[model samples]
Target: MNPQFEELQKRMNHIGNLNNYLEDLLAKIPGNLLSGKQQAKLMDVLLDDSDLTSLLEGLKDPRPPRFVLVGRTGVGKSSLINAMSGRYLAEVSDVEIGTEEARRFTYESDGQVYFEVIDTRDIGESEAFTKDADAEAELAAVVKAFRPDAILFLQKATERAHSDIDVESAKKMMLSAGYGLPMVGIITHVDELNPSRIKDPADYPPGKLALMEDKKGQLRRIFKEQKVPVDAIIPVSSYIEWSQDPDDLSEVERGELTIGFDGRYGIEELLDFLEQSIDIRAAIHLGMTIRIHKISERIALRFIKVFSTLAATVALSPIIATDIAVLLSLQTVLLMIIAYLSGRDLAFKTARELLVSLGGIGATGFTLRMIAQQGSKFANLILPGAGSAISASIASGGTYAIGKAAVAYYLKGVPEEELNKVVKNARDEFDRGLE
Candidate 1:
């Protein structure tokens, strides 16, 4: 066999092993920690019999994940899309006559299609469009042709009002797309609500938070009243957190102030909702398409916590060898999961190789010595005649360091030589406990 083909076969076998390991590990995690549905989806990509090449090709699949934006003009549909995609892919217009036709906006990165958005004209621009038989038929025909996977019914939070025509238009779009399709109710322009503006979203003032929640509640009530079968109603602001100069007067002059970096709010939550609400394959496709580094980092950190906890628990083993064995296994599995979450096409063997390069289980004796030398600092936590607490501390800290190293290597694409330095620095910090 060709050497390249032989290497491919080896990689495939390694991936198979990794998949089986993940299935077993996820099975062991309590259902409360990870819902059965989420576990199943995580395992779905692995459980399939498809080859690595085919799975990757599927990522670049031409059938982009389609989303239909349903709302009247000035509801911030274009702004919302631009925010979610982290780029100026949509044409944002201030005029009330937004997107007269079914405009398809495709988001791609590195020359690969990730997802598509069908931006339709304002559903109910006037009484003539809403009540006229011909206009309604034309709108329905356009939506039917696009066949979106989901629909975003956008309403402005500052408007504080929902006309019957607005509700009816939303219902009409849902019906035209065929019932049971996932529809998410989005209240855009949320920053314009009371409190007027906020700089740090993470530290929202109590009044601001309350007002945001109130707006969400109001939208939900309207959706319920309108009989719109929406999966979720979330409030978002496209300009709350700008990625570029928030006060860039040039962009303001162009009437594109809302289109920038770091201006996104609740967009991550919106993405999370879509991931859980849509098909697993579609979710993966979207993740690849959008390439949202923040969301990827968030997922990586979450898995880090999960594995860090497991490592701490495993460290409680009475026998040193048993503790070392379990910690190594747990760390190995943790790295694999992180690699996957980071969207890296890494094989199990490659992950293990990377772990070994970071001193892995082979250097556990050295790790033990390092822990012992630093054990005095944690003596207060370690009970007399019991070393388990110290072991737990070392395991947790080391596992955390290992997780961070893996994220830097796989996700951040840090060079191997530089990454080795990062790992060494991390281990030293863990040994010293930030002292």
Candidate 2:
């Protein structure tokens, strides 16, 4: 018991150190600290460094096809990576404990075409084992380390999209980290269909197999609702003994793809997509991905403002009644100082990453005001005078905690509501373009 407790403590300490380092590193970045033209100059340099042109030059295989297999735990993400590599590059199993960190496997055919596949473990794990924010950070690290050419979102076709959990989980991770990178879906485990199967619609459930045109429409409709656009959805089976008659009229192709010296699912289309569609050498996707990260960064920055504002209101309680106008000015001045102090440890690179979105500043300011007002309301509920500092501090702390949680919740939840909004906006803009 003591050993277990000690191990848990060690893990907590490690995470704490990592978080502290990130905060400190992000503080020194001039793009996050400076304002006006100075910030612009620093941003230009930072973006140039992070952009496609700079990173692509360093790639060992300039135009090598690289793909990251991203999906929920137990969804066979590692298996897909290993299958594609034609070797045991990534550990595979029915159980979900193998991948706890990012696994990178590089394959080269001849000297020209190189394929690097990255596997991340933060997707689709239980709440007890993973947090949404931690998963986002881990994926961001994966993106920063190896910006893949394309993403293969592997989902088990045999498994129904029973709940919104899987789609929502992937949405937050990708949008928060990978952003605008192109993605294709491989609905695996389709080989599980019975050998004698023909045209019994009841054999395959509605959502499981998008066999017919209407089924494809249904699948696309939901995928659209989830804000996940797939370039293609290829159904597959990775079963060991799975086989199909080559001459059969089954819409699902067989013997076209093989895995582990045996026939398996979705291998052909997956390979063809990578070979034909993905431009493994381009940098344009990196710039677009940065924009997606900016949306989350802006939301994070807003929560930070709320925290600092509440802190100031608590610290300056005594002078509030003396002059409301003067106190408000003092609060503003303090907020600026707090922003600097909090951001002091940020790195030049990390800050630029956080400030890519133009909307972050205004959103942060608005969120801070909301937090401050909530804190004031709570303070009014407390009896004025005597132990005011103690009461106000508690109120302020509660408000800050709730405010941050709310922002996190919105980032996870609002995208579902905003999916239709995004599609509508795209169509409206397209019509304007046609005009």
The numbered model that scores best in lDDT is: 1
Task: Quote each prediction's TM-score.
Answer: 0.54, 0.38
Where does candidate 2 have its weakest 10-residue lDDT segment? 283-292
lDDT at 130, model 1: 59
Please provide, for model 2 over 1-435, each residue's C-alpha lDDT reduced to its tens digit, 9 standing for 90 to 100: 134323322322332242343334334434433434433332232234332233223221234355666666677764565455443331222223234545666543222122456665455556643455565566666565566666776666545563245556555545645456667766655645443242232345654354533334555566788878668766655444223333462322431333333545456556655543555233212111222322232323333444334443444444333222222222232222222322232234432332122112353332343344345544545655533454344333333433333233334443333333332343244336436
Candidates' RMSD to native: 12.1, 19.1
Model 2 regions more than 4 Å off: 1-64, 82-114, 128-135, 161-163, 177-179, 195-218, 240-262, 282-435
Candidate that would win on TM-score: 1
Would you list the C-alpha lDDT of every candidate in the order shown? Answer: 0.62, 0.43
For residue 11, give model 2's deviation from the true position in Å: 51
Question: In candidate 1, which residue pairs get closer than 3 Å at backbone N, Cα or C atoms, i.e. clash?
Answer: 114-289, 241-262, 241-263, 242-261, 242-262, 242-263, 243-261, 243-262, 244-261
